[model samples]
Target: MPAIISHDTGTDAAESLVYTSQPPVYTYTTSLISYALPPSQFVTPETPQVAVGAFIFTPPGTSPPKVLLLRRAATDSYPNLWEVPGGGADPEDTTLLDAVAREALEESGLVAATIVEFLGTVEFGTSRGNWCIKYNFLVDVEEGEVTTNPAEHSDGRWFDLEEVRTLAVTTELMRESLVKAFERVEELRRSRGISDPVS
Candidate 1:
């Protein structure tokens, strides 16, 4: 597991560090409190489904970088809300990376060209008395047009980072995770010398 740090305020040599394939690593404290997940209402009923989300970003150049977001269909669980490409794990998936790859492709029709960064997992309790661990990752996608499944999402588009924070989110769970993902993505942008007009 990678160490999760709050940010890079500790390093003045951050520029050199960011050029590498991996981001700066830091450690975090964990609680010893014993907690068990109730029967899940999602992928399974006995354990939290190990899900994954892919935060796809365009390269930093000619234009400001953009991240993809998809709007859920009005009939889906979190209807008419924006989120990155992701979904629950299935029986066919052998590992978390496979699940992430499959989910990203299924949800947004984008294939992973390379795994850029691991944004860590966010654990949250579900209304059904169960908890879920969502593993988020940043990846470069293969060149292709994004095609959203009409049954899954109403529409899909790439949005600027600033605009993403202001949109209506489907769940408080994802809203918090999204914020953290944005921070990591921004850090990546800065490391690559991408100019940000937001600040």
Candidate 2:
């Protein structure tokens, strides 16, 4: 089993991993969305590999908001398994959050507009025996058609909570992350007065 660690910025419950370091905030804005970097740990030379994931939901006011999930290409590591749009952070990425926005756009053709919150981090061992720490966040994206990169992902769709529970997610950690994202969305809706029928 791959080692796992999480830190949910939306809650007060402490977990095995707690990120207190606040890096400089960076912002990226599109016509529809404004992406901002939240307080998070920086990637250092000691870390072998780091990845970033974006959990984006359907626009507000939808009966039951759905989160986007991508189907990995048959030739990819977890072929045909569904996962969020993300990948390894590139050296040119100014910050971990920048990687999140870049990967989301590259994989799903969605521009990350606003980074809602930092969901947490997931640590797992790669197939090559290297360890990778992936940081995930709840993001809002500009209105656009979902088009996945054929080489990396075969398909992409928005799935409701029930559908997500039944799908073949890439990893158990990923499923948990998706579930938490749903819960967070619900909270946001209630707080913002966006009416959503209970599911």
The candidate that achieves the highest TM-score relative to the unseen native structure: 2
Candidate 2, residues 1-199: lDDT per residue as tens digits? Answer: 2211111233332322221212212232231122223313444555568888888888767868788999999998889999999888877665566777778888988766555577788888887787788878776676778999889899999899989988999999999889888888887777667766536
TM-score of each: 0.70, 0.78
Per-residue lDDT, model 1, residue 162, is: 68
lDDT of each: 0.61, 0.71
Model 1 misplaced regions, further than 4 Å: 1-47, 126-129
Tens digits of per-residue lDDT for model 1 on 92-175?
Answer: 554455566677778887765544556777776654667677778776666677899999898989877567678876776676
For model 1, the run of ten residues with the poorest summed lDDT: 27-36
Off by over 4 Å in 2: 1-41, 44-47, 197-199
TM for candidate 2 is: 0.78
